[model samples]
Target: SLILTESRSYWLASLTFLLLFSLMSFRSNKRLILTSAFILLTAGAVISQVPVLKDRFHSITDTKNNGSNITRLMIWKSHIKAFTEDYTLTERIFGAGDNASKLAWRHFGRAFQEVTGKEEIPPPGELRKWFHGGETHNLYLKFLTKYGILGLLGYLFFWIYVIYRNLERRDSLFIKAFVAGYVGFLVASFFENNFTDAEVQFTLFFILGVNFALISETAVRQR
Candidate 1:
């Protein structure tokens, strides 16, 4: 799936989740730990041998040549500029409401254009396509742009709260896996709006539900 999507975010996040989960779940099993490490190394070696896949992987850091990377950077820059420059004090604190990043983007973009007769990095129309219902390609920035600092803090708190609840029953491998997957999601969120992606969101929340279920079952067993 990572190769097919050619998503650097997916690759990094999957590796993070797999490594963390394996270490946590098999910490006491030296043989299993060694086996997992070998398997990961073998997979990485095989991936590096594939020309197309190898190039895609390497291109993750090639902002100059990688169109996607460049575009992502530009999107972040433009939206952040919009938020800082065009957004009002109230908007900065509480956001401009849903789907308002585009408004902010356009407002600043057009003003910049009028003053300099030059288009912004993403250009308003091009950015509109990428929105996909308020996706700024970065979850943190997305919240900051549309939901403001308060929203961002709330979102972070929700994740922290869930992770804390799961950790209270740290013996459950299932709960540990849930935490690992969420850590992966947070890493992925740095580069993609995984939270806004419906399929990803569904899977994420479903696992979260199972995490709580496991925690509940353990509590009941203890009682």
Candidate 2:
């Protein structure tokens, strides 16, 4: 399903999860490692042989052929530009408030037009298509744009704390899987607004809740 989606981020994320989880769980078993490698290679070969998937995978780094990638770059550019240039000091610290990126685009949107020498404003249709109403398409950038430095820091700290808790009680395989999933989510967040994605959030938080419950159960057992 992930392969069929043709989403580069999801592919990378799933691969990262597989690699990390395998390393953490199966690294000591030579037979399992060999089997896993063979399976992964076979899967990769099959995926690469499919023309649609093959082209899409190759186009990930093909600047000229990927319009969506180029658009993502522009969106990222505008976001960074807005954060650096347009945000006030208070706004930078506390954020310009929720959904402020929508308004911030007005400033960087003109900057983009000036640089490209195109009238990129007020068709409403094109504007909506181009900016997607100020979505940075990046979880980190989205957090920064919505909640400022403090908010971004708080978010990062929360993740770090969760990982720390997992490490503190490192006996559970489920906890290791949670860590792997978190790493995959981090990779996906670079190319997506996964923070606001309901499905992703639900899965992530569900795993997280289970992890916490497992941790508490272990503590009770130890006591």
What are the lDDT scores of the predictions, listed in order?
Answer: 0.75, 0.78
What would the TM-scores of all predictions be? Answer: 0.83, 0.86
Residues 25-132, candidate 2: write the lDDT tens digits: 784445646765876797689788999989888887874447677667667777777888888888888887764766566665564464445684556566557676
In candidate 2, position 98 carries an lDDT of: 62
Model 1, residue 108: distance off in Å is 8.1
Measured by TM-score, how close is model 1 to the native structure?
0.83
Candidate 1 per-residue C-alpha lDDT over 143-166 given as tens digits, one digit per residue, 9 for 90 to 100: 988888999999999999998998
* Top lDDT hit: 2
Q: What's the lDDT of the predicted structure labeled candidate 1?
A: 0.75
